[model samples]
Target: MVTPGPTSPMSPAAWAGRRDARNLRAPVKKSRRPRLRRKQPLQPLNTSPLPGDSGVCDLFESPPSSGSDGADSPAARGCSHAPGAAQQLAQLDLQTFRDYGQSCYAFCKAREGHFHPRESLALQPQVTAESRCKLLSWLIPVHRQFGLSFESLCLTVNTLDRFLITTPVAADCFQLLGVTSLLIACKQVEVHPPRVKQLLALCCGAFSRQQLCNLECIVLHKLHFSLGAPTISFFLEHFTHARVEARQAEVSEALEAQALARGVAELSLADYAFTSYTPSLLAICCLALADRMLQLPRPMDLSLGGHPEEALQDCLGKLQLLVAINGTSLTHMLPLQIREKCCLSPSLK
Candidate 1:
């Protein structure tokens, strides 16, 4: 059921074409820009820590009462708010992690659906599919700017969607929610999370530090502190390693294909349609399509993932449509060598 893969000649390009596109969230910086908040950095919440627990603050606090002071907020501290104690993970070193990688993948896959939201926007009275896309477009560039890993991006979207599913949000507060989700996701996987102020600065200071801190607590509470979700990034890396170990494809070829697949996966993040598919399924389909696109020799054994063929085909077909639509952006996102050789498969056209 898969459509013909777009044969993108890869090259030095990486997310090149899209950065210039107007950020739905860039802070106004010129005379044409405003020192004031309008759309970029719109206001969201206010924060103050709950009483006690001085070693670390509560990951969440009840909304401030009319009688309370707002002194313990992230703004009050002048630093990135560390995710409260609840989000901390036990130390698992790289060698130890690799030794138990498969078991870890199993644990993550089992919990993916528990953390994932089905038709998340169906609950939103204000946010729409288009709005979600716009928000993600801006987020992609922001994440790249921050030099965050792809795993963080996946978890960020998961946190965003799941929180939206459980809460009713205002259109005005949606942008704040987006950054708040990113912050929470960063805490999960990033060693040096972006400062609350840095994120707000990108939004052009439309959102205050307090509002972001407040929302962080709300998201953590709403999701019940379940942050370790499976991601396409994890599965993509997993399948790529398996391909190399099986000696099904040359390391160079597999790496190139994996790079292209990552761009595809990033595009998928903005797309709500792909959300219902599990990370493992999407990762396999992406690997399959990448092989076809890069035309890698001795392609990966898809059976290793153990997903049904029909499900693979269905996801592959939709991903083809997505690649076709974003063919130019995808090309620009690839390295220069591949960019020159790459062409969208005729079938996609």
Candidate 2:
């Protein structure tokens, strides 16, 4: 055995063997050791209570009853909590809202002349405006009977006009066309649409279920599946809402005004003379007329430059004449279904 002396040169193999023997004889050290934990920054405690944090707060409060005198209550003033309340609250700047309204009005006003029923009538002379009005008048009772929304009613009329403009049909098929349009509108707008059986019954069996379905296909195809036209009622709702906000009108008063506006709009629907007015202009005129009837302190501001003042005045005069000729009272001129549903009698003189 060769004994390796300190400071003496040794073969590389022998040195390696010696190092391995020493490593094996020594105890193996573990690589793992307890890691030092990092400290986290502490959060500050909230000191103030948020709005509606108390159990007594009526955050999601209901509107005050019509009979109640609590018109100043938050809910009655349209301050009730709703879904996305926080988001709406964040955007509750009045000036900002008014600006948005003006912009929306401008946009809709720009597109107004494009959607007049007169344009449609020009193409299809066979479908006279008088016949159109008669059909729309009939739709009111049907709309009420089925409990369809105002949106559905307006959409139905829009579909009717668009389809009539593109395709010419015989006078006998007008009812069928109206029924199919109503079906399409209801399906698009209602959560649960009126069934085919209900529609057939409404038509008094004038149209077979197959005929109605086929007509629907024809209308849909003619319109290219575009049923998203903005109707007078759509703009009317927004204008009415804005009027309420602008005037800070009470809920009952607002409701009454809107009901009157809707009645006027429906009356316009029955007259071909109103067809020359754009939906926006017609809506503006309706709001203006309703405000006048109510004799409210604040008049609606509907003056967009280039608005046909002469035409609006002419239409308003016609509407007044219709109301006068139809019945002895304002409520009488309004469809009975609208009067009862909107509770218009209590507010109107």
Candidate 3:
């Protein structure tokens, strides 16, 4: 009991040697639970509830089912579907649309001449307006069949005219040019353009794939890759959107008005007579005519300058006659497409 009772403290070197010996003897076993090297700093408990805090988070809450008819649900409000959402958003901001429409009209007016082909400067013998019209008439059904957009059709015609004006294309190659321009336009504007085979079939295989490709290259080169020019259809759409907002039209009614206006604009596109008229002027005329046909409110208050009421009336008269003539031909040629898209008979009449 007395042994080592009063042992003096060991020197530093001796204590270190004893610790090293103990350490070399065997590895120490660790506890199953991990031990922190240092105690964690003490933190005060949060006794108060968070602002706007509920018992549980919304992340844990179940979402409304797609089939649910709840008014607050996104699906029920038509926001889940792309097309419906687009339409809903389009109709939401009517208050600022008037200013937007005016700006579009003004910009189109300023750059109107730039959009037209060089009519006065004759580089070579070009296709006649009648030939152009015939080619476009054929292209329409093809465009409709492929489900291409109206903008695509407009761009195709633009590409055709710009190419013809700059390059000397023979009458034999006119159809080839038309199809090629359409191909270029489709690729530019469409999400899923008609393939080469489909385009050849549309042409009744009159032109080979190599020929089509060659013509597309030629057109692109001649036009200098300038595809940004706004067509009458572009201005027409802007005016129609503005008119729809101005009149507070129902979606169906707005669509009807747009169809009528587009029908008139398309007539202008087919006839070379409208080449003299600016796209802005054509848009104004189409909108005015559509408004009258739909028995909707007049867009007369819109800022249509650079021409008198008489001039607009005269242009509208010409547009009406062209629509009548084209409507007849359209009925005979692509009757179903025309009827379905333009509602030509009732609207034009």
Candidates in order, TM-scores: namely 0.71, 0.66, 0.64
**Model 2 regions lying over 4 Å from their true place:** 1-104, 123-126, 248-251, 304-306, 328-349
> On a 0 to 100 scale, what is the lDDT of residue 323 in model 2?
54
Expressed as tens digits, the lDDT of each residue in 1-349 for candidate 3 is: 5676678889999999999988785667977986677568789655454457664554454453434355343333223211232343454455555557677667767776776775622554757777887998888767765656678888887787777677787888888888888889888888777788978887687889999988877777777787777777667656656656666565555555555666677777888777767677777787666666556654333353457777677788898777666666533432232245444435356
Q: Go through the candidates in order and give each one's C-alpha lDDT.
A: 0.77, 0.68, 0.67
Give the alpha carbon lDDT tens digit for every residue of 1-349 in model 1.
Answer: 9899888764545445455464447687766654665667657555566567672444445533433254335343222111122211211123444587678778877887776688999979999989999999999878876767778889999899999899999999999999999999999898789999889998888889999999999989989998888889888877766666566776566666776788899899999898889888888888888777876657667788888988988999999999999998887666665666556667667
Models ranked on TM-score: 1, 2, 3
| lDDT at 141, model 1 | 72
Error of 3 at 62 (Å): 18
Please give the lDDT score at residue 127 for candidate 1: 97
**Residue 300 alpha-carbon offset, candidate 3, angstroms:** 4.9
Span of ten consecutive residues with least summed lDDT in model 1:
81-90
- Model 2 Cα shift for residue 245 (angstroms): 3.0
lDDT of 3 at 274: 74
In terms of lDDT, the poorest run of 10 residues in model 2 is 79-88
**Residue 242 lDDT (model 1):** 64
